[model samples]
Target: MSKHKKAAPQQRQEMSGVERLGLRVSSMINHPIAQTQRWVVIHRLDTDGEAEWEEVIGLLAETPELDLTFNDDGAVTVRWERSALQERDDFIIDEDNEVETEVAAPF
Candidate 1:
């Protein structure tokens, strides 16, 4: 037998003024038409946002390959470099079961 009990569904709650304002203002930030698209994180509660933001900043700070900077206007910059998949050399297996890089023809 289980010790836990199934609770009844809670009643719906109305949105607070702060929540409504936050949602409205927060929505305007990423919606600016200057940039066609950008990544965004939406948190329903403001309480845990600080910790999450700090974690992201710490991750960016500790990673050597990642570029992390905070602008004076509260803008954050994060970018990284990666080799294109097409730039990688192809591989082939010989009848003798030896693996070798396939040579490319010169243009």
Candidate 2:
């Protein structure tokens, strides 16, 4: 009889503290309010000091999607071009579709 060997279960990689922070920052910046204003201010929280926040901002700024400005009051202002978001097809509104949906009023 041949001996059967069981395969070990694979473990999934988890987000690091810094990565988690980055995700939160990204989400806040991508929110409708923030995206509409084209800017968002991120203040340092009690859990993270200026240095720590700076590190997180640095990591999150690695992408070309955001523009970061470090403030003297330990805040970082992030901005992105509307065009950057508009490049995505979903962001584009189809005016033609809206016109088509407008039905003539009944007499």
Which candidate achieves the best TM-score against the true structure? 2
lDDT of each: 0.41, 0.64
For residues 35-83, write the lDDT of model 1, one tens digit per residue: 1122222332454355555554565467565455576654455443332
Question: Among all windows of ten consecutive residues in candidate 2, which has the lowest summed lDDT?
Answer: 98-107
Q: What's the CA error at residue 10 for candidate 1, in Å?
A: 16
Model 1, residue 106: displacement in angstroms? 40
lDDT of 1 at 53: 53
Question: Which pairs, if any, clash in model 1?
Answer: none
With candidate 2 superimposed using the best TM-score fit, by how many Å does residue 88's alpha carbon deviate from the native? 6.7
lDDT of 2 by residue, 25-107 (tens): 76766555665566778866676655656678776587576688888996788887777766765343232332222332211
TM-score of 2: 0.56
Each candidate structure's TM-score, on Cα atoms with residue i matched to residue i, is 0.33, 0.56
